[model samples]
Target: MLVLSLAIWAVKAQGGTFNYTQPDIDSGKALQDLSRIAKENALKRLSSSSSGCTADNVYFLLFHRVYIWIFEEKLRTTSMGGNGEKVNGSQGMLPGGTGGGCIKEGPFSNYTVNLGPLTARDPLAHNPRCLKRNLNTEICRASASLKNTTEVMLESPNIELFQANLQGDFRYPESRKWGFSVHGGGHFIIAGDPGSDFYFSDVAGTLTMMNRPPSRNGTLDDVLDLEPLGEAYTLGEMLDTVGGSPFCFVYE
Candidate 1:
């Protein structure tokens, strides 16, 4: 068993701020520590939060970002021997695999995700189980480069254009316009099947509602005026952006 410092498992930090940073995959121990902390916090939040932590209530990007931010802070504090200083890094994406198969590596390998089966009438009431992932390199891979992300952002000056580009048809890979399509690709790649939170359904619709800025006129200009699009971001920065946005409070 990996022997971790007692401070690593200390109570979650409250109202503290830290510089955004990515997860260090270079250290398997650090990766494992981060994943373990993430899983624990995920479960705790699911059990205690007002929304019960279901996909239906907690928006995917916002909730997961908050989850990851919490994980990042804990990991940083532990790795630095509990100094509690600002850390720099982002969440590590799951490495690519050959074909569709269970996720067998990373800190989340053995971790159990307690709140899921989005189909369950009351998913939170279900028992905890090992986190499940179906990685598919064929359809989704690390090939999504920063260039592509930048290009998409550049093309999508406003929310309407961004949404239109993102809702591309999946039949032809090349036809996946941008934004949402790429977003879906990441989800499919990371969570390939029915078990994934990204699995298409009403849950995705909920996420869309959660992500979109409220609009009265329902025009791109209005929405952009409300929340302007910015540069591409790492997973950590993305989470921070979403968590700090007005959308975070919109969920309740």
Candidate 2:
């Protein structure tokens, strides 16, 4: 069941923590626990000098248990194999797993990704290929440990520091400087040919910001261009998640 009681203790020492377990997932107690814990911790904050509830306090262990359960407990295959449709070349083995290529079974077995593995020219050009995943627990253990995520979340004070530590900035590439960000850990949790390249890497944007001219520090006056998604708005109007103009929601 992987209770991780030790992990829970460690996180408690830090500030908060996620105590993931298989039974919690199977019995569906995890979601209920989140709602209940958040309410309790929020009330605790309301009456005390403690800081507000954060991700660690609200929902711990949900991602680890549920994600792993999907791949290891239910699906039961490390690799999502390929169907025998004719192909140009091999999908090849993903970084951490034994030999693997296209998905052959499951509901998403027939699904195909139509885009570049984008390490190629015309990256945005349409090119259909079978869905593939190289799920590896070893990779998760090496990169996404409780200590790794906890440090990134709690230790860093500012958004820039948090983002860099969580994303593993190249500016400071020492293992002693930071743990590989959980963002990378989570990405590789779904690791594969294209999974590695799956959405544009945020690290590049962070790098761009690091090297930009002065006055690049974002301000409320900053413009957010949603374009086709929505009209543009000043960053100030968007900061207040609950009452901000063009935005209305409160995080739980």
lDDT of 1 by residue, 1-252 (tens): 111211122212322222223443344455345434544454465554433332223233333444444546567655412111222333236443333333455555555555445456754344676545544554453334455445655677676555444545345444365533555665555543344334423332432254332423221111111011222223333333447432233211
lDDT of 2 by residue, 1-252 (tens): 112222232234447656658888678576445434443454454443232222222111222232333445344544544333233444345344532466667566777776555466755456788777656566577677887778777877776676678668777543236544676777766655553234333321222233322333444564543233244455566566567665455533
In order of appearance, the predictions have TM-scores of: 0.36, 0.41
Assess each prediction's global lDDT (C-alpha) against the native: 0.40, 0.49
Extract clashing residue pairs from model 1: 21-88, 21-89, 21-90, 22-89, 22-90, 23-90, 166-180, 166-181
The local distance difference test score of model 2 is 0.49
